[model samples]
Target: MSVTAQCPRPESRALRENHPVMGADWGPFNVIDTAKQDWARGWAALKKFTEREAHARVPYEHKEGAYPLGQWVAEQRRAYGAGQLAGLRARRLEKLGMVWSLADERFQKNLEAAKAYYDQHWTLCAPRTETALDKPVRQWLSNLRRPGALDDHPEWKTAPEAVDKDWNPSWPADWQRHYAALRERVRDEDGPADVLPGFTVHGMDSCRS
Candidate 1:
């Protein structure tokens, strides 16, 4: 049985006030995935990397690469802010660099691949500011290593796969078989087999705690 509990929504003001970076400008980081899967995945990867590095939920706008990382740096440097990691020692960029280096080997590989993906797919922002795509891969990786307060977001990024909203999971046949076996219990001695299934019964009690 599920409890119909009324919990706070993601749009709650208390939460929003706590997350000062949520409303930052998306600016000109227009990506080319018309389907938006690339944007979703890239953001997810960025969030995952942040969580693993700091063991907390870091927030940022979905303005592709530059905006989010820069936002993260600013919040982290407060050193005592809610977003900053506990007991943070190194200076902002140095600490960020150490975290970048500490990422799992697989994360590093995926981040590199994401850099290529962005290079090929991302379109230049209108009134194009800089030729970010022209930056070499080494420079791309280096930027993430040591960031400054106003530094542009790092390159070589990736994200988790976007979810398929239209997909629905059907009941498995194995589960149906197990349910049928349990239904057979009605005929054994405890209940009537002819009775229609309903919420009236909770079934045989488990032997284990």
Candidate 2:
């Protein structure tokens, strides 16, 4: 006769079965997985924004369907700058035309406003209260002209200079505006320009010498 030998289950397995610690009520939670899902959701929102705007330079206060996409973008930039962003994620954002530096983005926007002002007036000597492209052009120029304002980004000066060589003239901006008006009048008129005291053109007094 052949006898069959039965092996007893491990004590730990019996304990686990009795305690039911690994039942459906207790499931594993992965924080990394949750964070990845959140990141993917933000990326989707950003992708949609880029599809519509053709760029990922989201404003600081922008939102996409209740998601703070701009804040997410800013956080990504910070992580990238700190070398904490994953390489794949950075590449994906770069592919979408992400503007990493807010300062550079702001400068480009202001430069566009300056260009528009020059196009309209043929000069960049706008008054302090002047606005162009919904931006405070004169105030932006004043800020750029402050001492050491562009110390870290000296190359920014060349952009405005390219738009107008005398953008940052040694003479007063008001004087430049008057000179521009006078030149325009001379060009438009057929005879020698007659300049008398108290004469005004383009709302500027020609008598103020």
- Off-target runs (Cα >4 Å) in candidate 1 are 1-96, 105-109, 115-158, 162-209
- Per-residue lDDT of model 1, residues 164-194, tens digit only: 1111114442343234334444547654545
- For residues 1-209, what per-residue lDDT tens digits would candidate 2 score against the true structure? 99999774665554544455643232343124879999999999999999999988898799998999989999999998998996899889889898888789889998999899887776888887899999999999999888898899977868988998988899988888877766665787777878776777757875564
The residue pairs found clashing in candidate 2 are none
Q: What TM-score does each of the candidates earn?
A: 0.16, 0.66
C-alpha-based local distance difference test score of model 1: 0.38
The per-model lDDT (C-alpha) reads 0.38, 0.83
User: Considering every candidate listed, which one attains the maximal lDDT?
Assistant: 2
Off by over 4 Å in 2: 1-38, 49-71, 83-88, 184-201, 205-208
Cα distance off (Å), candidate 2, residue 72: 3.0
Error of 1 at 129 (Å): 35
